[model samples]
Structure formats: structure tokens, C-alpha cells
Target: MASLPNRKIAAAVVREDAAHRQRLLDRAFALAFKGLVYAQIWEDPVVDMEALAIAPGHRVATIASGGCNVFSYLTDDPAEIVAVDLNTAHVALNNLKRVAILHLPDYAHFRRFFADADDAANIADYRTFVAPHLDETSRRYWEGRDLVGRRRINGFARGLYKRGLLGGFIGLAHLVARLHRIDLGEFLAAKTVEEQRAIFDSKFAPFFDRKLIRWITDQRSSLFGLGIPPAQYDALADGKPMADVLRARLEKLACDFPLDDNYFAWQAFGRGYGKGVAAPLPPYLQEVNYAAVKARAERVTMLHANMTDMLAASDAASFDRYVFLDAQDWMSDAQLAALWAEVTRTARAGARVLFRTAAEPSLLPGRLPDALLDRWEYRAEESRDYTRRDRSAIYGGVHLYTLKAD
Candidate 1:
């Protein structure tokens, strides 16, 4: 079969060389990304909302990763949200989620399908309620056979949280920990951040020092499951050993936030969200925000296309908010300039752009032209604060920029 347009876009951004080794690695990463990558997005939507300052009547444009943040943004009642992605699976996932919210009988049914995410009854629910309303393209994707010949929608019945590329990576990490006689689950048992720190020091911290583990992490291909391309891996490493960087980031994830409220930690250590009703969830998944999200679900537009292309086709000054979700790290300088040119042209007065970086510094300064770069005022201090507070703990920095007054 010919490559999908979205997949082709992914190739264009990722395949940066023709050398045999480099070409092989790039092809492998693209293939891994072709299917579902993030069953749940790794970025913290709470931080995104706060930095974006999403207000009623704002037009928001974002990259649709796992569709978690897109759904979470609905609670803010934006006038419109255009979620564009170069992953067909993510596009289908986003469409499936919005349709589920619109057609599922109630919040209970919705919660059971997504939050619990492991019961076989979810298949019946999908068939009876969600599948009918889902766009035909998405329906085909969900109903399609996987490499193992099982239907993709069956993921909900078999621990949806444990199915995608990120999920598989986490599972492998857990297995590696098991080999080291460390149970990552011990961290999740902590009742306080103090206890979380203690557990990490005792059980998890030492695992990173093992020669075998360090060697595995040193390989660029080892990180493909986490969606880190070669260029992104270099940025993330920033001259430090990959093992050291991962350990520090994992420490933040394990100890910086309370166990009961940090869903990112839960996903990291527990392999899924906690089952309790009070377990932290993305805003859209919380019962308190259910009505608002459902009511605003229709406002979201899911597109399987490049984010820059989406902006290029949009009217000037049409969007007041943009979220790129670390995708700029994958772009060449020319690609970054092209993307920002569209962003600058399409942004409304006082518009805000939010994104994360694999490294500590914003990637735009020397890359984009001085003329275009000067149009936006970088929120340097606030971005550092946002990076500190971001619960995801995976990214090195979270940057925000607002368009300067014309």
C-alpha cells in the first residue's frame, strides 16, 4: 500500500539523511510512529491550559497527540479547537474520542470506556454507542486488523493504556526493573511526596546505574518507542549521558508531585491511571468537567494533516492560541521558519503560542529569522516556572511566546 499523506509528512520531517545506518534508523522510527504512539499523551494539559490562558471565545490550534489535551481543552469552552496531526492513528483516536463524548449514554459509560479501559464490556459500548457516530475513516481504523491480526478496538478490552508505543516502552521499562529486582510499582504506593522520594532512592534510582541499562539507553534506537527521533534524542541528551538525563527526569516524575494527584507518575510507574474515583485524570475525563467537555465537544475539529499546513491554509489572524507540543524539535531550520511564518501570519492580536522543548533553551532564537522572531515576545521567566511545575517531567523545557502588538 502507498504511504498515507500523514505518514509521508512524518517521513519528510524525520528522514534527514541517506547514509545506510542513518537511513535505517530513520525508517525504523517512522515505522514505529506509524501506529498508535502515545495511548495517553505525555505532556501535562494542566500546565498547557495555564500557560495558554485559554479563555472563552478563543480560537485554539494544536497538534493532536493522543487527543488527551484536545479533549481536556474543551473544558475551557474555546470558540473552536482545530487539532491537526500527521499521525492517522492519532487523528482516528481524536475523532473517536469526540464522537464517544457526543454519543455515549452518560458520564459513567464514558468513564468506563476510557478511564477503566480494561473491561470487555467497552467493546459492546463501542459497537452500540460510539462506533456509529465515529467518522467512517476512524471507524475503519479502529475495526482494522493489527499485525497480530486482532482488531485494534480490542485495546479497550485489554488494557488500552498498555497498548501503544509509549505503553509498550513503559512495559519494557517495568520488565527491565524486574530483571534488576526492582518493582517500579513501589513508588506508586507512596502517600506523600516525601515517601515518593524515599521509594525512588531505595528501589528505582540504582537501576539506572547498571552497565547493561546504561548501554541500552545509549542507543538512539532504544528511544524510538518514546517517539524520540535521532535529532530529538541529541537535543534531549544535551551532552549528558542519556542514562543520567533519564534518571533525573524520572526522579522528578517519581518525587516532585503527590502520588494521588499526578497522573503522569501513575502512568509512568503504575502502567495505567489509578482505579479510584479520586485518581487524577485529564480535565475532560474528570466527572466534574464531563458536562462541559461533552457540551463543547462539537467545537473541536480533528484533521489528519500537518500543523503548519493547516495554518498555511487558514485565514490571517484567525487563531489566537497555538500549541505545538514539542514537534518543532523535529523540524529543520527551514521547516521551523515555514511553520512560524504561517503562525505569525495566522495569529490574532495578543495571540499566545505554547510548546515544549527536548532541551532547556527555546529552539527558535537563532533558527528563525530576526525579523520574524522579533514579532513574538518570549516569556522566558514564566517558561522556566512552567517547566518547573509541569508534572509530565519528561521535557526539559516548556516555552510560551505571545505575539507582540502590531
Candidate 2:
């Protein structure tokens, strides 16, 4: 049987009394999610920061996945940040990042641990500095052995980004590309968008037409590594072949942004971030923003709980910003209403909510109650623009809603 937190994950992901095949996929997703999913979150914080316009003193509530955006948001210096998640591994990862940021001697050590993430010294550093300062839960998780019997902290020494489910998925993708005699790393060498498009056209786009690729992508379980639960998988597919959707997303990832600035492209193509101090990185990992993020690390409080439950227990009109991060796409109609009701109740005046969707349109119009929907203004035009600007290219929509002034 799954543990309590795993059961909570199942409650969120598994629909009740579905067809046998659907139930299997849902259960498989829940089981896969029991371990680390994302080593680095896929959403673009640069786009998020622009959409939210996070000003100083705002209190932000968000789902803490890989802790990338959580720390990046600290650059804006929010008064308080409440990060909630159901995944125990994610909660542990987030807490570990918090303590590491708090106690690591300098930016170099921090960068080496996260950015490089392939040095044996990192395990030593974790024991010497980060582990002692980490909370008991997080410490135990890091020291604990994974299913393969390697300590979780050893991930840092063995290339952390290449170890999670997402990492394994990417590794498989690279393997597939290799079997086709295509090197994904070639995309990273392109200095211009035209070059990227050319490489993608010649190497990647046609690969989707292969029979094995089509068959594999058609199965919803195949995407579990990307953290696409069954519900979101249906939305992402939208009755179209999954290969087409994936190809389109990969096109955007390859050609829509300069490789020099998009670390997401680096991660996808090079299997990790680009080399050296000058490489593109998340804001929290960048040297220029290091001090600000490190200083504000204490402002964040990570919890292993459902977002709605956490909000329900809080005082009304308390939160200023909300970031859902595609989690809402996993919700049913009733769950959507329940979450939005709590969101509306807890939001302060002029509060903003930002979330990504697997589909191009916002999921709220037909799903959320009119009364609750009437109290917020959806920034459709801005959302569309932000969606295009999102360098990650994995999401189809980036919706923003602002609470109407009382």
C-alpha cells in the first residue's frame, strides 16, 4: 500500500470508478509521482515574474515542485511565501534547497551543488554543511536510500538533473534520438534561431512520424515521466495525436528563444544546463541574483499539504499572489470550484493568480461558478502573450487572473 502522502497524491490524481484502463494509468501516475518527478521545474519564472508583477511585500502562495521558481521568486523579495505540495519527495527537495541556500558558504558552493551537480564534493558538502542544518524530515530523505539503494543525496554527486523522472524521460528521448543517428546536443550548438529551426526540421520534426514514437506517445502512461497526470494528458492531447503536440512544443523550445538565454533549451538538448559561469540558469542560480535569493530564503515556508486545504485553514483575504503551475489541469469540476472558492476567500484585495494549462484556453470559464468567476478579471490578451513568451514551451496556456477590487 502507498503511504499517507502517496494516498493524498492518489486522491488528487486518481479519478473514482473510471474504466479499468484509465484507472491503471491514473494509478501508475500516482505511483510514479511517489518519487522525485521534476529536478527542475519546467515553468519559466521570467515569464511568471512578468505576469504576476510581484512587488515587494506581497505574500505569494504557490506549489513547491523542484524549488526553482520558489527561490527565483525570492528575488522579488515577497514578504512571505507559502509553498504547498502533496509529494513528500518534492517537499523534501524544497526544504533541502532552502537549508542549502541558508547555510552554503558562498555562491560557488551553491552553484557547484545545483548548477554543475556532478561533483563528488557535493555529497561531502551536503554532509558537512547542508545536512546538519536541514530539517529532520528533509535530512532523512536525503540520507535515505532510493529504490535502487543509492542515498538520495548521492544524486548531487551523480548529476542531479539527470536522475529524476523528467531526467529519465529526457535520457530516454536522447537514446531514441541517438538510435535515429540524431544528436540532440547539435541544437545547443546553433547560435541562431534559423539554425535551431533548421536542425529541428531536419532532425526532430520527422522523427515524430516514426511508428514506434507514435505508438509510445499514444499511451498516456508514457508521459507519466513528464508529470502529466491522466487528466492533463487528455487535455494536452485534445483528440490530436500526441506526437504532433510534442513536436510543436519542441519546435517552440528550439526556435522561439535564443539558446544563450533559455536554460530550458539547454536542459532539453544538452541533458543539463550549459557549461560555465556564463551559461543561462534560473534566476536563483545566476550569480547576479544570488545574494538577494539567499537573503530571502527564510521567508519561504514549505508544507506537505494540499493547496486548498492549506488555504482553507488560513485567514480570509490573506494571500496576495497565487501560482498553481498546471496543477489545476489535474482537477475535476468540483475540485476546481473548491480550490477557486478558497482562492477567492483567501485572496487580498487586488490579488493576482497565475497558472498554466495543458490546453490553449483557460479551463475556468465553463468549470468555475459564475459568482466566483465574476469577482476576477482574466488577462486573456496578456496571457496569450505570456504563453508565447514562456521559454519552457511545455505549457499551452499561461493564464493570469486578478481579483477585482472590493
Candidate 3:
């Protein structure tokens, strides 16, 4: 996997002044992402689309974590979308989604395969329809077995959404909540924001009050399942108690959006999109955009490489939009500068870049060179607007920047 370098880079970010402490933190992050991290992306596609304002003439380069947003971007009808990731598992998964979208007979089967993911028939569908069409790398990944001895593809038949690193983390959260006599799933019955808040205050808020739960959350390794590196944990948990931050985020997840349309809430509370609830499905799975995504599936290209390397090899002014997806939080000052240098070189006029942060402010000012950072104008007002509307409710900030005209 090309992730070793990323792991190394991540490891190096922890200051060595602390000696043993920093090294231990580095190892944890390196080991955490050795396998599949996110079964689905956590970013809100609606907010991303609004921020990027993608047009048919634009070419986009985005990190392909779980690949949901890559397909969602297709709805905007961009000229090209290049999905890149250092994690080979994620790269393979993106390829699988692209191929599945292209090869699935219709929207119904696609929904069955992904949204209603636990049906055993999906195994047959995969073998009969999706598997043969997948590239060798993706085929090998899906066909491969985990520590439990089931092939990864069987996860679809068993509940694809509940199988990855994030899935396991949510499962743990559920178990802990159950131990406290709280049924997290009950939050899904909320019809209005008030009802949602009431349910959360009555049932969910108490889960965080437990000392055991707070201790577990305090540990950085506990968040590895969410693909959060140690550096990100430091940023997220800075001055506040980790449990408090998590409680606030979970509160937002449960109470800020209507349960009817927020698939993220469905995933968090109901585990698997409530079996047949198609209305809350991700944008790609939704019926209205299904045909359009299928038609444009071929336009996506999945690459197994770091974003910096990918951008370095590309033609100058080749791309119009970039989606960093909280990756900047994992980088060092030097690494951030190198990345923005390439981004500045490769971006076309009016190019837009979007990213999320574990912290409230953008990381560019102190970390990136002033000259490089000055080349783009930060859309602070728009970022704040979109951040409020982001249904995922996980990130601290959502940011957008556009290139300054020469």
C-alpha cells in the first residue's frame, strides 16, 4: 500500500521533544489506518456542492475516503473528477463504487446492493453482476478475508455499512449506550427538531455522563475507527474535555437535522438506513440522481497516490476544484506548504478548494507559507454558512477558498 509514506508523515508530526510519548502516538495513527477506515464518508455532500459550486467545465481532485462524495460530485456534471487516496483499501473501494454504478442493471439493484446492504442476495448480485466488472485490485480487496475469516464482500450481505472501522466504533458506542440502559436507536423516531432534542436529552445525553464512556473517549485510540489520527485528536480535544466535545457533536447529529432526510443521523442512530428507507439515502443512492451518476460514472478516475504527488505530476492549471476532507489536520507545516505550492501551481483561475477542519479556524495561516496562502482568497462567510448547513455535523469547520486572479 502507498500508505506507508503517509503513515510515516503522520508519525513525524508528533514532536520528538516528548520522546517516548510522541513516538507512541505516532505508532497508534500508523497502525490505525492499516486496514479499511471509513465504510462511508462523514462529509456532507450538500455542503460540499454548495461550497465548490462545481460546474460542467470544472475538473475536480478529491480525496476518495469511502468515495460517496466522489459519486455525489457527479450530480453537478463536472468535466472530470479524479479521486486520490494513499490508503489502497479506500482507492479500491472507490473503484468498486465506480464500477458498480456503471455495471448495476438499474437503480433498484444499486440501492439493494448498497443501501439495503445486509440482504444475503447481495452476495449473489456481487458475484453475478458487480464482481466481474471490478478491476483486479478492487476485486482482490473485496474478495479478501478479514481476521474473522469472512470475505470482505460478505460484509455487503451482512451489512456493509456496519463493517468498517467507523462501523466498529459505532457498534462500540451502541454497546456502551446499551450498558447504560439507553437505546440510541430510539432517536430515529424523532419527527421534529424539538422531538429530536428531547429524545437526545432524555436518552442520549446521559450516555456521556458515564465515567467509563468518558475515559474511553479520552483515549486517542478510541477514535481510530473514525479515521481520526492522533494529531486530529489533539486538535479536536484541545482545551475541552474530549467527552464534552463528543457530546456536543453527537447532540448536533441527533438534533440539528430532521431524521427524515439526514442519512448521517440514520447511520448513527439506526445502523443501516432503516432497511428500506430510500428517502434518506446518500445522494448517489437517491433515485433522482441515480441515472445521472450512472451515465457519468465513467468520468471518475481513482488513483492510489498521495494528493501532493498526484498534483505534482499533473499539468499546470489542470484542476478547478480540490476537496481535502480534513486531511490538512494530519499534515505538518512543511508538508502543508508543499501541498499548497502544488495546489497553487495546478489550480486554474477561479479554482475553488474545500476542506474540513477538526478545529474552528483554517490551518493554513501559520502552517502554510504566507505567499502561497495569499494567492487564494478564503471564503470565510460562505464557509461559516455551509458549515452550519452541513448535515454530517462532525467537523468543527467547513472551509472554501478560491484562487485570486493574476
User: Evaluated with TM-score, which candidate comes out highest?
Assistant: 2
Highest lDDT against the true fold, candidate:
2
| Quality of model 3 by C-alpha lDDT | 0.86
* Each model's lDDT: 0.90, 0.93, 0.86
Which pairs clash in model 1?
Answer: none
Candidate 2 lDDT tens digits, 1-406: 7799989999999988788888888998999999999999999999999998888989999999998999999999899999999999999999988998989999999999999898999998998999888889888888999998998899899899998899999999999899999999888889888998899999899999999999999988889989999889999999999999999999999989999999999999988888887799999999999899889999999999999999999999899999999999988889999999999999998999999999999999989999999999999999999999999999999999999987
When 1 and 3 are scored with lDDT, the better candidate is 1
lDDT of 3 by residue, 171-243 (tens): 8888877887888888877779999999988887877888887898898778887888777898998788889
Q: What are the C-alpha RMSDs, in order, of all predicted structures? A: 1.2, 0.9, 1.9
* Clash pairs for candidate 2: none
The positional error of residue 45 in candidate 2, measured at the CA in angstroms, is 0.2
Write down the lDDT that model 2 would get: 0.93
Q: TM-score ranking from best to worst? A: 2, 1, 3
* Whole-model alpha-carbon lDDT for candidate 1: 0.90
lDDT of 1 by residue, 1-406 (tens): 5388535755555555546787677777777888899889989999999999899999999999999999999888899999998888898889989999999999999998888888899999999998878888999999998788979999999898898889999999999888888888877778878998888888878888889989999999999889898778989999999999999999999888888779999888888889979999988899999999999999999998888889999999999999999999988888899999999999999899999999999999999999899999999999999999999999999999999997
